[model samples]
Target: MKIVNFVGYSGSGKTTLIEKLIPIFCAQGLRVAAIKNAHHNFDMDKPGKDSYRYRRAGASQVIVRNADRWAMFSETPQGAPHLSELIAHLDPADLIVVEGFKSEDSDALRLEVFREIGRGEPPICQSDESICAVVSDKAREAFSALPVLDISSPEKVAAWITEKLQIKGIEKC
Candidate 1:
């Protein structure tokens, strides 16, 4: 399995890019999975629900079952694991796209959000060795020579990924 990552700050359109990319990858007839990292506490269980009640009762892990599906929610004090261990549950698919995890030193394609015209935050391209290319506002000035793509044009980004990774669909493989 191969791995690619998207990294940017909050409100940087990372999720939107991923949402668009998933379908492109899927249409390629290759299995694609994504891992999203959430820094804050979040609850998938509704309050007053049985599982929530059990968790409220101090259960470390709760498994709620039904005929169609089963989900296990566990609380760990150590926080999210590194990339390798977290993907154990995924289907042995073609590729895994990771969102967030900006600190990880693995190969990554960066996304830079240019909020205003002539705006200068040094662009994410100024630094960060892990960043391969940058997707940003459709302006060339905001980005250096490292390949600037339209942040809104996810198809182009998807195609670029395929070309960069030299990815042939699973059927082709």
Candidate 2:
């Protein structure tokens, strides 16, 4: 599957952009999957729930299912698995949009998101050679060497991604 990693500092609109792009891709009948990297501890199951109780009661993995959907929760006390290892567990798709894993070296295409209003941090594209393009809320002439996309225009970004991957249709199941 084709992969693209969107990296940015906190409050840079990475998640918002991804949310907008998913539907655009889906509307075109492409199978799209996303992996979001959480920086802190998080829980998907609530307290008193069976899956939560099972996990707390020493079950290494707990799966909760219903007619509509299912979710798998696994303990990773050893440490978080590498991005590639995590990707191995997912079903194949036409595109995989990764929201984090900015520091890890990988073959996935990288797009750096930058917003000038918040964080006031320098763009990662300055130092990260793996970045293929940048999406920003402001004009970034300094990054003239790379393709710069407008943050408000997710449709253009989605089109760029589809063209880059040469995606024509959904992958066969």
Question: Which prediction has the highest TM-score against the true structure?
Answer: 2
Score candidate 1 by lDDT. Answer: 0.75
TM-score of 2: 0.94
lDDT of 1 by residue, 79-170 (tens): 77776677777779787888877765654444444444443346565676667777776666646667766888888988888888878874
Candidate 2, residue 104: lDDT: 91
The sequence of per-residue lDDT tens digits that candidate 2 reaches over residues 4-117 is 899988889999999999988888888889999999889989999989999999999988899999899989999889999889988999889999899898889899988875
What is the alpha-carbon lDDT of model 2 when measured against the actual structure? 0.89
- Which run of 10 residues does model 1 get worst, by summed lDDT? 111-120
Let me know the TM-score candidate 1 reaches against the reference structure. Answer: 0.82
